[model samples]
Target: MEEKYFTPEEKKEMLALSRQLLAHTREIQERDDFKRIRHIISDGIKQNHYRRDRYGINPTIHNLNTAMLLCDKISPDRNMIIAILLFNLCKTEFIPTEELVKEWGDDIAKLIRGLLKVSTLYSKQAAVESDNFRKLLLTFAEDIRVIIIMIVDRLALMRTINHHPNEKMVHDVAYESNYLYAPLAHRLGLYAIKSELEDLSLKYTNRKTYTDIAHKLNETKVKRDQYIAEFIKPIREKLDATGLKYEIKGRTKSIYSIWNKLKKQKNDIDHIYDLFAIRIIIDTTTEKEKSDCWLAYSVITDMYQPNPSRMKDWLSIPKSNGYESLHITVYGPGDRWVEVQIRTKRMDLIAEKGLAAHWKYKGIKSEGDLDTWMNNVRDILEAAETGPMELMKNMKMDIYDKEVFVFTPKGDLYKLPLGASLLDFAFHIHSKLGMTCTGGKVNGKNQKLNYKLKSGDTVEILTSTAQAPKLDWLAFVVTSKARNKIRQTVHEMNNRSATLGKELLERRFKNRKIELNESSLMKVIKKLGYKTVTDFYDAIADESLDINNVITEYEGLDKKIPDAAEIRSAEEFQLMTAADDDSTSSDVLVIGDDIKGINYRLSKCCNPIYGDDVFGFISAEGVIKIHRHDCPNATNIREKYPYRLITTRWSGKLGQQFGATLRIVGNDDLGIVTSITSIINKERDTSLRSISIDSNDGIFQGFLVVGVNDTVALNNLIKKLKTVKGVKDVQRSK
Candidate 1:
């Protein structure tokens, strides 16, 4: 071991924590495994395999803390503890997987592999809010223990983050804990870990509010304890007479929960009822667990008036995470409502330890529901073109929602999130069924495809050979599978149309005995204001652009051709004011004040307004064309003609107007177009040159071509138009 890497006290603390962790797995403590693990770590230290993380926290201490948390709270097995110990060594490649497998076994090696993959993902600095990152996390975590270990690792980090040297690291870790890890823990039924994570997150992120709540809880501890004791007194007497072997304890709500209620309900802590809950854990056999819990519920409700709406019977159908409990809110002493939870020892274990406890009670209860959910995860991860973040939002919604159990006509049950539409269910059963579904008969009643399903409804789907998915189906389906499939189908349809359109145009040229010139066709396409050949062809297939018009433009290209010196790319550019902040010497073009000698103009493909990042592309004709850095053609220009590119920046202000187009969509309310025109007319130095409107299904989509002095004027017009009545969206045409 490297002695200089740690203080004497630090080394002693790590040694003690390591011993405590091994002790949880008694076989490892008794055998030579402990010393072997220690030797591996010493070797890792010699090779510099372990070091402080980016937050400047000791790796050894952190891993030990995480392992101890797993042991003390989760009741994990020997392999889980060993994996946590050697994870860092394996991650750094100091210990190869072959050696790990030969010594530690395959389970240990597999856990470390999952951890390493997740570690690599983190090194990319992906945001916690990124849905793709979250999906990939689950994909990498094939073993449930990998997720459990990660959750505990995050908890360990949160507990010691006060010692972190970087404030930004502290804040980011806290935010990730709150938004990402906390919800995951909740989903897994690790309520204790979830609550602690949320509370610690509040402590670091909002210290003032955390301190206020902490002080209030501390100040009222005495009175709160007395009230709980008084409330439990009579309930204890009733259960004791019944000769039930049970333990009852009072649990106060975490600081974060209190703060959330205060903020949401707009009430102080004093007004928050159910601030504490009384839990009753019974020692009963699995066969009698349900009956025993019911007996306790009867005894408690017999003594006090029970609120019917406040009762939750998870005992009948346990939660998706296998959490089983009976909760009842009763008017306790002083008429204050107090919540009581009744559960067996087995149920309590699963509730507190999540999947770890579920592993122990594997066959005692069916995990088919959980298995179904895991399969849904795989379905969502299928190859699709949708953005990962969008997919993640849909997945997160499913994770946080309560399941609605519906049935097929044959009595096969399917679980969906709350508010799941009929289409969502059809997709959940099978993708093909969902695609062809027009509507369904729910419990023998006809319902539309958009009908929201409820529990216990037997659904029989109705389909037709002529029925096809519509673009509007994306608006109703909530599942990512349905949404992704719809998008893919729509994209395929457009591609087919584009292909057909291309064939039709080519056949027309063949029939007319007119030779098609590729370059001339390109010029015609550009002149038609189409960015790509696909869009041009699709327009022809849809009959939006007349085929004869395209041929006429192609024939006229020769007559309208400019001289070589005057020819420039069809792209637009802008001149920024000298006052713009983006101005830099390196970005400025080397064109001097003798500007008349240069026959250059802004390219028409990308409209680069004033203050936009601009670059100069020297055309083959020696005409320098200014283009926006983000132009659609910029990538091709940069990749294929790197030598022709020159760094350019907007210089002196040119007191002239530039043309821009805006696309707007909103309700087809009375005079909505007039309202939009009025708003644009009010902006100074902004003029609307032309407008075209199309309306369908009470919705209107329009395009407006306007001339503005600069991007500033264009943006101002957009903002003012956004404020118009019935305007849902307004943005510059890309």
Candidate 2:
């Protein structure tokens, strides 16, 4: 309940711990580099403290102290203790890893590297949470001690969380503690640390739940203590008679756990029977360890009637986290159900301290237990999308989830995340089986691919060669393996389709006269607005494009007209005669495929401007005639002579003269024609070739023929012509 600063008690303990650490390790005080290593870490800590404060960062002195104390508590390994001392300093970049490794050795250096990775795993990033978590979860491969150190570090920080000033920081820390760290701790069999971390996290993340449970527990502490004393009296008497060296303790449910049950069962604290459990820890040698637990279990059951359904014999098969115990519920005084746990002292120690203790008291069975535990953790991470948000979003389902053991057709059991689907099961077997599986029978009844599987169901996957992965399969499948395999299959299928389509296009182009370049073809494809070659080719293969027509679209691109009436491909016509910098030879701008070595004349019927939409036709005079698309004779000409219709547009530059006629309407006023003529003459590049006017009944109408360089110049002239006295409108005549 104190704001854990550098109190005298902590200082004394720190002095004692430092002395004990120096006395124990051959790598540190017993070596030539002891003073140097100590100086480096000590100096780094001071500088880091100053740096954090200088940058308006929360000083982590208390956090460092807490971590150091925790390291000593978890293990007396000097490498770890010194690593803890310098971990924060290195994380904050006040000191580098080279300094530690150079002075101390590789053992310390390796642990520091693992600590650095642990720092990165929780650093804020743009990536989703699961990605960071996936890498973090795999840190066991780096050094088993890294995770042990990390778990202890997290426990230390949670214990001193009130020191953090930022509300968001506190929330993030607490959230990760509850959802990630505590679950990890529980998995490692660090029951005490796990429970405390949960309670601390709930205190910050959900204060109301934490406070309510703590308040209720506190108010009834006297009555609960008395009940525990009374309940253990008979058990203690029986255990003493058996001459088993042991310790009996009463364990209460953590506030967070209690709060969870309260919300789940909707029960008051008083109604929550078995809110605490009695743990019987007996001492035994290695040979009699299993027998001792059974002996203790019998003693407790003899004093009470055991519930047959509420018994768990984990002593026979220890938990994956190296937890070995016999758990049972028995009716106590006044018919109240009380849970009990019996374990050997070594088992109890491992249960209390988790992986660190297990490593200290090394056992062959513990090694196997850890292998199984770590394999499960790795499997969950490997099979799932381990993005930051992905893992964080489904932490409840992945990290703290209850496991379901389903049987394959061969009766072999496979553990899956709760709510795993049938498709997930198939993918778990093999990617190919998953892709080709159509459906499966769950417990002899047919079920869909997305059916949520339950424990003990015997699944028989039905597969067919015709069955292939679909795009929609990603929506229903949750496992990363299934989703990624589906994506890979889709990609391969698309590539095959695109290859075929590209081949068909190349052959089609070969049948035509013109050559096709992949670059030019791709340019045209993109200009048509397709995102990728895959989409374009998929369309081609699916009949969305007429391959023949598309191939011909590019043919005759550079055609030349030799005879008057000779016609080429009715495709885009390009006026390639115009030079890039010099457009004086052409009056009209042309846009389309190249129509080089051809002379074209403007048609008299439509008098199209430089920017007007036009088409070309080979005339009888050995020249191409260009006409506006909306010309009076355009429809009749195109419908009667479809092959003669060629798509084209004018491509003219500034200072190139083009001809257009304008019509004007105005009020009949004196000097109106003269005023319009003056305005047109004022334009920079204007030639008023001719003008005609008629005035009657106070209204005037005029027609003017003009030549200008381009649409910009012509538009400028028309705008000035509209400003003439009494003028109503001026428009280019078609």
- Highest TM-score among the candidates is held by which one? 1
* Model 2 per-residue lDDT tens digits across residues 434-483: 97788999979999989888655679999754356778878778777888
RMSD of 1: 22.1
lDDT of 1 at 191: 65
Q: Which run of 10 residues does model 2 get worst, by summed lDDT?
A: 570-579
**lDDT per model, in order?**
0.72, 0.64
The model with the greatest lDDT is: 1
Off by over 4 Å in 2: 1-28, 32-34, 41-50, 53-60, 63-67, 88-100, 124-135, 163-165, 207-212, 215-226, 229-250, 278-331, 340-734
Assess candidate 1 and give its lDDT: 0.72
